[model samples]
Target: MSKFIPLSVPNLKGNELKYVTKAVETEWVSTGGPYVNDFEKNVAEYVKAKGAVSCQNGTSGLHIALLLCGVTRDDEVIVPTLTFIAAVNPVRYIGAEPIFMDCDDSLTMDADKLDEFCREECILIDGKLISHKTNKHIKVVLVVHVFGNMADMERIMQIAKQYNLIVVEDATEAIGTYYTKGKYNGKFAGTIGTIGVFSFNGNKIITTGGGGMIVSEDKELLKKAKHLTTQAKSDELYYTHDEIGYNYRMTNLQAALGLAQLEQLEGFIKTKEENYNLYRNKIQEIKGLTILDFRADIRSNHWFYALHCDENYPLSRDEIIRYLALKGIQSRPIWGLINDQEPYIGSQVYKIEKAKYFWERVVNIPCSTNLTKKDALYVIECLKNAV
Candidate 1:
């Protein structure tokens, strides 16, 4: 087949064109406009957060979240090592060090291990969780809803409460995912945390080319994030500034697109869920491969269809990825364990064994909502043949 099956791509099936054209016609193309505010409001309403702040991208949103969480230099933040590096980069952006933690089979931070790390490696000082290294307070716990699978939030939140750590969620891939039963009932993924962020990148379940949004229950923090992104300008008409700021604000054009995309967010979730089920049924029939399960109690948007290579798999992850590439199918291995990366080599990490194991076996398959059933079937066939 000449067609290249991409791992993920934006679905422009909604009112994206109409909204974008209107933005261009109105000349509302800059970082400030009605669309930007409307998009922020739409997301906030959807996630049930008090307020939302749109940023240039998820990384920027995360950076804003870290700043809001008070992640100062050399302070330690516990993060999962098995996720996309984008999720953990914000910890470093705040000049804080990340303490890499392992992930469970659900592909989220292993709360069990995190509790162990906190109880054993961390010391309590003056009602704050402090890392032994650098003697700085370990103020935040950054947890990711990996591959659209909800993390063990109950346990994670419990650990955070017990240790008095602020929870920051990287829900970039799990925007529509939510836990059905918990203290956070009817709660969306990002809203459950102290602060959360979502990515609107081209590769995500939804896209505005590139954008992100920060949400928080604290109204003050949300205002602060918005202020920081818009150069901390004190006046609307006058570009007067109070604090040093960043040009991380989301553009009007992108916000227009995001608003359009948000209208189809539920439809996209349906398509992605269907695609995941199709892949799961087909892959399960083949030996030595299993699709990672979403938590049974929650509904997952299934942003990715991750195939975990069983112990007796015929091909290594690298070999399978190469095979998929040769067939014009784009497959990706999991991100490198963050702690193992050269930039983070000396950062504190504990009980990283499982995360490292996943790094070698997890492969993200094509899971775009734009992928048609026939295209999905072709991928299923290719996997069976390759195996």
Candidate 2:
């Protein structure tokens, strides 16, 4: 047995080598090239977005989106404490503070709690959502569609519109997910907000070695993101700079890989969903161990398979992770609650009840596109016997 049933990994069985080799042969290995533009176009079309801009990684894309949304030092951005730190770090980068919130049953931002948070603790100061505890103006709500399940975006957007706040979606783990029944019926994850970001890291569904993309419906917003990602250069040849910017551009080589990966996005998503179904049918029979549920209102890509430990569960999440580790399986605990982390200890957070509950009990199992039926059965057999 090898200790390498990974939680996630890139699929390079498509046109990766051919395109990357072509880029190398053409001497377009650096940031500027045709593939970069083409990759952006493919993603924008895939997600049904107005436009897209590629960047160095998801974090930089998020920072640029925050800048475009006017997030400043005195501003507060609402975020989920249960999400990966990368989703919230951009709020701090803009000199803005993060106000950690709770998650719902879907493990996404708690939409119901959001309105309650605003009604109880927030005050409208000259048309701003102001927090009395931190004395910061809450300017944006950064909602994450955790593990590819669609967040309750329709309600969240309505709340944003009423509160005079911008909604920035961190759909890094949920590129293909979208609403199926709500006001945003046909909208894709990243396409519904003021701005959205996606990742192409090694462990994502697809990869460009390492890169990201940002999208927005507004042409001006997309333009600003494109300019800022390339160091905010006003002049291309002379390279004159005005405002502070980031060297967050993705290379042509990476874009070439992304272009190849985009061609398989649909197939990758389909396989992932199929794997999730096998896990669910098997795991559901065992009490205290239940597979995550995708919302019926949305068609999920099932990016990750997280098991919730009920009272009858044979072990705690940590115990299960250790058991799987001993059996040469790779599983993971959810991110440590952000509000509980050392750096954000003093930051303001709403009553994050659900997020706190989930942080301790969730264990993410192997869910990769490359997982074969044999591999899935192997995992299920181990899980059934482990308990």
In the range 188-270, model 1's lDDT, one tens digit per residue, is: 88988899999999998889999999999999999899899988889878788998789999999999999999999999999
Candidates' RMSD to native: 1.3, 1.1
Weakest 10 consecutive residues of candidate 2 by summed lDDT? 1-10
Which lDDT tens digits does candidate 2 get at residues 288-316?
88887988899777888888887797888
- The TM-score, computed over Cα atoms with residue i paired to residue i, of candidate 2 is 0.98
- lDDT of every predicted structure (CA atoms): 0.89, 0.89
After the best TM-score superposition of candidate 1, give how far the Cα of residue 273 lies from its true spot, in angstroms.
0.8
Single out the weakest 10-residue window by summed lDDT for candidate 1.
130-139
Query: TM per model?
Result: 0.97, 0.98
Segments of candidate 2 deviating more than 4 angstroms: none
